[model samples]
Target: MYAYQCIYLADVYLCEAGKLLVVPMDGSHWFTMRSVVEKLIERGHELVVVMPEVSWQLGQSLNCTVKSYKTSYTLEDIDRAMKDFAGTHWTVRDDNMVSLWMGSGYNFFELVFSHCRSLFNDKKLVEYLKESSFDAVFVEPFDMCGLIVAKYLSLPSVVFTRAVFCHYLREATQCPNPLSYVPLNFVSSSDVMTFKERVWNHITHFQERLFCHHFFKSVLDFASEVFPEPVTLYDLFSHTSIWLIRTDFVFDYPKPVMPNMVYVGGINCHGGKPLSKATKPGSRTQHGYDPLT
Candidate 1:
């Protein structure tokens, strides 16, 4: 019997035209973004993804038309920076649990904002945006800098949360913050933080907020002088509509939320299909053997 080899390929489908461009920050972006894009495409939307070089490479391989932004520093650089500042110092010894101290130094938050601005103002990107028009833009809040671009284009924007929903941002929106009364990571879950982590989280939260305010102030102040918007950039973030949080209703915590603030927990996995039968089970050889003979 002659053995035959066969290969299978899925049809290439162009994402339907007219949704908007999606600007995802990094590989650590919300995992649900891909699913959301697919659903939008199915509903007749074309997606142009603006991503950093690393994300572009990955997104393009997955068939997305990617806009690449160049960055000088690597993830390792940020990691080292964090370790030196917020992380455990090897110089210290004799501790059951190493306590991290808040140090006074160059504001790491401002440094991070500067890095974000560089990506935002990439010349090629600005030119592209000047020519291209998008219907709307979506971004994760942890990756907040995308909002700058959205604001520049005067386009509507939505924020998706990758971590616990931010109470401060919600309060800024005039919505009741569910986590305001509850401590950070205090939701009813197996993954809730231990006592030490909670304490550290609180400490770090204050430090981060202080620097974040300063960072936002400097950026917004400069942008106010330059941009045509009547409201300050910081003010713009407060009034944004439709904040989608990843917390489930099962968490049993609810606050006086604004109509715009929606609990979109696990909405990322919505409308996704599993791998096809042919893509699983049998090995490639089992499906059809290759005979070199």
Candidate 2:
């Protein structure tokens, strides 16, 4: 019976053994993607992570192949940009808010696109991708670089996000995004928006669209050199198999979602280890919780 069970497990493992090409945005985005990678590895799938040199150490620790590429920006650059723009008092009404959003978006796009361009220039990486046979590409579609790369390799792609809502992804999927009721991610409003808030949301959504269009136009122009003829980011994204969003209705406002969009909120919370003795209920001391005890 034990031998039979072992054979059964081996067959299951063999059945589940498929290669995945994971393309994640740099910096804290890796932390968000880490759980997904772990889940894939647990399910017996091989992962090929294409990341910046700074995250090579992290990739080395994972049970998968790591492809490191040199990039002009580092995690520190992202951190600095966030710190410069992020503050408590900023609001949609503030003039500086627009500047903040624009500046931050530009920095993020520059970093992501620059890294992607570096990967495109890497002959060895390109050759390896061409040779590799992946079941699917798992990507954080911050820009369409992941989709472009997946197109180059002729693999199906799955786009995932840690954000509550992504306007670009919504547009790509042609998902319903009613600005009247649905607040923009940057806009601090609820599902039941006031008249003024609804108007503000519309304006913000328009701005976002314009910003993305300009940036994506430039990205696609650069991508034409790397991707084959008759390729567009919209086409690539529309054909994606699924979008695993890290949000749930409980924590987020009600909104219409497409069939391909899967709400995987609290995926990281599930199957997590229980709290230790010190943090567990009734384990706290008068002085404080003693983890060593």
Candidate 3:
């Protein structure tokens, strides 16, 4: 009986295996996405990861094909840019919140735009990817490359994300976000709102729309250059077939979720080594060498 079950499972796994194209976000965002990648590889799927040449963790020890594209910025340049952006918050104090965020956010946003331009300009990589004939695109929608690629190739897209920046997920998915009960993350700190809080939420939603128009100007322009028809960031995101939300429902507040959204929280914790007593926080260490050291 056990032998027959093994043979049946093997057949099912063989049938399910497919070629997967991965366009992951650089830095810590890649951490959770890697777990999904590792699982797919174990399931006998062929995986291709596309990334910038100078990314930190994307280059290390992947048993799959990787296509690294050149960028305008070097690793050192990126480091300096990061420090420059982070240092702004430490040095300056502005009373006006709008100006504070706008100044820093816009400057930081320029790097992303530059990277996007660099990717698009690499004619060879774009052409190769178009002809690769992959099954689907698994993307971290933090950067819109994966979303655009999926649409360009007309391949089904799966989004592996924590949250879409600027709370764009609500608009993109056409998911109803009733401000009275459903808290706008940018507008409110708490989910449960008072009458006054609810009223402020509605007012702030309008203000956010106005801000986002200016904030996403580059994205709108980029979309026009990429595709013939007019496309917005929300439109690209709305094309996603599956939304793998990295959030635990037990710890998270009650919120509306769409039919396609799956909360597979703690994905980063998958395949991790068991924490030894010494390695665990606040753990008693008998040996002289402690994990804290």
Candidate 4:
């Protein structure tokens, strides 16, 4: 086994060289997963990326084999959703917050699912994957379609989420999530929570879990109709080889993580040239800071 180390990216262990099929959710997600794909390619692993046509620039820059699919929703739909959410009058009240969250969730889901549906219907994409003898599949965990494709191809799958924490992936991996101390994503709470805050966290966590469960269930049912195999979404997720979460203690609060759940946070951070002594504060050169003595 070979282990590579870096200051920003997580330490990855590779036992052998093989081709990896990368499936990114959308343009934004393609940008997030770009570094990972690039690292794999640098390690002499072949890569095949499947992404939305909106990310054609990214695919072209990667200089790898790519299969781009068209989506029904346009960039305008995304802009509208952002405008609606940002334009809303936000408040601390439960009703107002809940309304905003749910509305945004629905709009985002519609946009994502529309793309997923289009990817499923692309016979050429499906045929390409069927013919490509990929060793494993690397999927962004935004949609279940990638998991379904992995199942259809009988390949081991790994999930890489750009978020600090993904509740669905955590739950699927049976990781310990003590809601009492672990705050929900966007809940604006520290590791230690007050009694009332813990209660609120529990309620919000439960609500999100319930909503996502049903949402994925519907997606799974629709996928089942199109794919020849009859596997539930839960099965596909539960069997995932690893869940790569983008997080690090440098910025994130402490939390429990399972063995399979690896934190690759700060993987995007890159180093630059050091500050020259001439440019340093209290130096004599131009742009240098002057002492107040």
List candidate 2 segments past 4 Å from native: 1-14, 56-60, 73-97, 164-166, 228-233, 270-293
lDDT of each: 0.55, 0.70, 0.75, 0.70
Alpha-carbon lDDT of model 1: 0.55
* lDDT of candidate 1 at residue 145, scale 0 to 100: 63
Clashing pairs in 2: none
Cα deviation of 265 in candidate 4 (Å)?
2.8
TM per candidate: 0.61, 0.76, 0.82, 0.78
lDDT of 2: 0.70
Cα deviation of 256 in candidate 3 (Å)?
A: 1.3
Q: Could you say which candidate leads in TM-score?
A: 3
| Candidate 2 lDDT over residue span 8-56, tens digit each | 4645732436778988875566676887788778877778988777542
Order of models, best lDDT first: 3, 2, 4, 1
- The predicted structure with the larger TM-score, 2 or 3, is 3
Clash list (residue pairs), candidate 3: none
lDDT of 2 at 205: 78
Q: What is candidate 1's lDDT per residue for 1-293, written digit by digit as tens?
A: 00112345476543325647676654445366666666665655666777665332236444456677766556666556555755444543322111222241133434444545566568777788757777677766554566666777777777666542234564556755323344443223233556765556566456545645543565675456446765454555763555776667666444456676677776645565654344445555444443453
| Candidate 4 structure quality by residue, lDDT tens digits, 9-47 | 357643556778887765566666888888888887778
Clashes of 3: 0
* Candidate topping lDDT: 3
